[model samples]
Target chain A: MFPSGHPERSAVERNGVEGSRDQTLKVPQRYSSTPLRSVRNDEKVSRHSSLCGLALGLVLIACAIPSAKAQDFLDHVDEALSFSALNGEVRARVSGTLDLEVYHFSGLSPGLIRTTNDTLFNPRLSLFLDAQLGPSVYLFTQTRVDRGFDPSDRGAQLRLDEYAVRVTPWEDGRFTLQAGQFSTVVGNWVPRHLSWENPFVNAPLPYENVTAIGDKSAPYYSFLGIGTPAEKYEHNPIIWGPSYATGVSVAGKIGQFDYAGEIKNASLSSRPESWPITRMDFANPTVSGRVGFRPNEMWTFGFSASEGAYLRPEAMSTLPFGRDPGDYHERLFGQDIGFAWHHWQLWAEFFEARFEVPGFTDADTFAYYLEAKYKFTPQFFGAVRWNQQFFGDVTNSYGGTAPWGRDLWRADLAVGYRFTAHTQLKLQYSFQHEKDGGNDSDHIFAAQFTVRF
Target chain B: MRCLVFCLCLLSALTRSAPAQGSVEGQVDLPRTKSAPVMTKRYEIVTTGGVLGTNPPLAVVYLEGSFPTSSNLPTKQVAQKDLAFVPALLPVQVGTKVEFPNLEKDTYHNIFSYSPAKRFDLGRYRPDEKPVPSQIFDVAGLVTLRCDIHEHMRGLILVLATPHFVVTDDSGHFRLKGLPAGHYTLKAWIDSRTTREHPIDLKSGSTLQVDFPATP
Candidate 1:
């Protein structure tokens, strides 16, 4: 009963914005579009994003006065680019990176992407503003204007992915308080999730895989198989991208241990629009935290856990008469490890996620990814990531139970070259297939050119 | 014995040392840093266009003159420790071998340079490794060094053609000695992209003093 092109692939409908997460080692996010079948409110972010970009550009120009003699310009460009004032007590810098990518994938389906174009182009510009107000207080922010905000979606939009004020009361990052919108505290990949920082173009399976658990609708568990009914697959993801939900976090190090905890407005699976407090309040805030131990310079180990309401108020009407939206929750626990030795760097994360859905059995998924990158030279590097997801058993109406979502795996290979310290070009290839082996058209190839200022 | 003597004669061209006379001494007023230097971030646009140091040790002073090239120059050492390149600026005569030893326990350091004058890759290795790696700078130009594993780690190698050169001291004081009578250009370097040069005539057994204005 499947369509020829697997337009019913049922993956990544709203995941376009999922790729736009934050980009400073200071932090990260996931960006993607909403449902292909629905209208997007993000178009407004696109229309007004130009104004936002102009305003920011004006600030940069006002701060930097490089319009002088070539020698004078070169001599004081960096000084102008990163301005200092108040007798050097206050400093501010404006930096940005741009990515222009082209994608050629075997899978072409209306449900996953609505673009009828032959070659899919995704262009994104990430602007970062960092200010040091004082020795103890600092601010970091990133904004972007991109088509769909997600790589695969069609449309142009602008969004402020991250903004945080950090207060480090002491030295060596012992204890710090950070507030405003920031990357989730539940994982380790966010640090390298940016287009210029990350070795691969696509995020790991856990961040992008769209499970049959939409926050907008009540799930249906009485199913015989995965993807049998296409609509069921449009639900929610175990963890949507960097989950840049609005929150305040405390992250710091004590000896060899690093601890971080946050109270956020939305769950890990909430859509991008719900990330801001204006669209969604923190009535039922999600609390997430992580504890990390750096045994040595080469290795880091971490454990993270998160729990909160995953469903939105829009889903309230679809739930049981007596239950509210917050009645259901999403719980997750994960382990992450990182190793950097010589020219080789490795990172691995394993997570067990559970979503309490209404009118259905709880949806549980086991997801993990192992990625390794090796530098061939100072300017060149290659990387490979192995990602997999396994769904737990769900009680269907039939005599037997099936996995809530399909079990799938993907492998991504990439190589990148930095032409200069500020410019880079990367190429990537990925092969994704399901446990059922239904999606043979999931092979994807993409390339991106990035420039950072 | 005859062949060995012949090889020794050939090696003298590379081992030739400059005479201990004709010194050029000066003080460079380094541009004062406005604030405490931040840790290097890979994506950060280096605001201090200066090549030498993020914290101190102002500039590298070198001379360009007609001098025999040498492949047997003394080797210098740069260590990778605390996730940084020790002695961030290293000025050496062309053809001098520079050794980069990883000194951090558990961590590994892979030092490489993309400079056209001296392009080399010292494969990734840790201190636990048997031997520290080294590379020879055969060309006369600036070579920027970086650690592959750490984006924040940066180093600069100023490879000079002449033996008359000296790195500025912490107070931005430099004294380059042993130059023959000839017309030469005295250059002061901060980073690969930034440098100042002054043409001068050096007389045998004479001392010349010059100062570079503070330029950070």
Candidate 2:
């Protein structure tokens, strides 16, 4: 659909045969001499002329409305006239990383299959486009193309990670409104989760390991065979909070406090095939927001929350006809803190999630991570991160079979050398352990090089 | 020979009919703090007290009035070398044109300023390319110069309406000479601090002594 006030055109028709004929082409002598034939030709010419005029008029209207609207908008919001010049600014940037890793997993026991131990290479490329449309309006989009060495999967995948239009109608950007698909504002790390911005190779547990409903592909859930009783007690995790969502957000800073809120599509039941929230089948929608306080330059603390229905489409369809969908709601709460002093930087986050599933006992989960980085020199730095997740006990109402909660934790140590502001080399080692009445552990070693222009 | 004789005659005439000019001299007293041990290898310009406590050389002293007529100074040049501005801070009269030339042969630089006094961006250009036009600072305020390509490179331009200004030396002493005897407002400024102003009266043929308390 076209924007408001734009000229709407359904279709335009032309007499293809007559329009394509040359002016020099003449009618048959018998028809040319007939008054009726001449009259018909004249009518056709008149009709064609009217169509041409209509087309010209439509084009003129289409071109004039946008410029007039823009001028009017600028006139009303004239405090930032200098920013209007920014409309002429356009920037396209590209950056990515190539990573090589070796993984070794052992100690699989008690109804769990052993994970494969192998070497793999993964490459990611990102493209960013930013443009200013007017003094108070701008557009930004970021896309990523990634390829991993998995013999069973496709060679590569491309995704549009973020596309947003931001408008600052007030002076000094004191108030902003953004609409479109964008990264969630639940935590600080999600905004800077790119390979170049992140200090470590992998994301925190809450962001990477949160098991969504019906997500059989999750590493932790892979052990549950199809049609197994354990599969019926799927629980929601905080992972969906950081994924991109299609919605509108309002964000601004008032004094030392900053706040943002968004209403987006409902959470996904499984990992999206291409992008997050491609469809919102249910009437339920998610609400996510964050509020932060920065009393000084070195420290900030924030609180975030999300609530909505997270049931898969198929699961929702199977519910009783009169059952209220709101009964299967998912809720999450998180707290984050960041501090930077001289050469040291510290970040931490804690998350708690609750899910209400039909025909099963409700589930609750908890996750948190702490990371710290020290700059040894202007170009070299070392970082360490610890992430852990604990799942709630699940009970099957039909069979009365319950599984105890599982706990997983990982520790990562990494060092990076930046050859320039736009290039870096990093090496990282990680150890992961899981405790759920079974033995599960893994070790990972990785190296990555990233460059940007 | 003609030029030499003209210069000598002019010198004698100026000496005979020279005005009785007064001078203002002042010492900036900075509070001393604990000093670090001498380093074997110094990377930055580390003063005895470092940047936080008591570096007096960072202050700029100037007189604000029309006692001395402002003159159009020649265009100044700030060179970009080793990813740093040669002179980190510079004070100049209003209407001065400043040229930023990249001295690194292999790299390109983009100089820009978003200061309220003046806003401009000279897009990226190579060192060997033809010289770009100089940026004119016509307003009276501080214009911060930066390189968009090199985030760490920073330069400051203090554009003042008055012509009489001097940076304090290492010894914390500054002298502004050739001032016609009159009452004027003396001002001292340090980075990220308030401006200190004092009313001073000067007599002809006399040197006035002023002491400016150091900023915390």
Instruction: Name the best candidate (by TM-score).
Output: 1
| Global lDDT scores for all candidate models | 0.69, 0.57
In CAPRI terms, where does candidate 1 land? incorrect
- In order of appearance, the predictions have TM-scores of 0.77, 0.53
lDDT of 2 by residue, A1-453 (tens): 222232111100111112222322111111012232233566657755654554465344334433433433422222121221222333222223433222222221101111221233455676655544434555667776765211111367777777877776763335678877776777777744666657876677676553424422211222121222133224324564346667777777677787888877765222333124566543677788889887765677999898876654555454545655555776888899987654677899998887665544566778899999876765577999998888765443223322224577889899986543345667788787776423346676655566543
The clash count for each model shown is 24, 0
For model 2, the DockQ equals: 0.03
Model 2 over residues B19-120: C-alpha lDDT tens digits?
768888888763332121111101010101111111123567888888443465788888887566767678888888888877874445667665567766
- The alpha-carbon lDDT assigned to residue A231 of candidate 1 equals 41
Off by over 4 Å in 2: A1-117, A148-153, A210-212, A215-237, A268-270, A274-277, A317-327, A398-404, B1-216
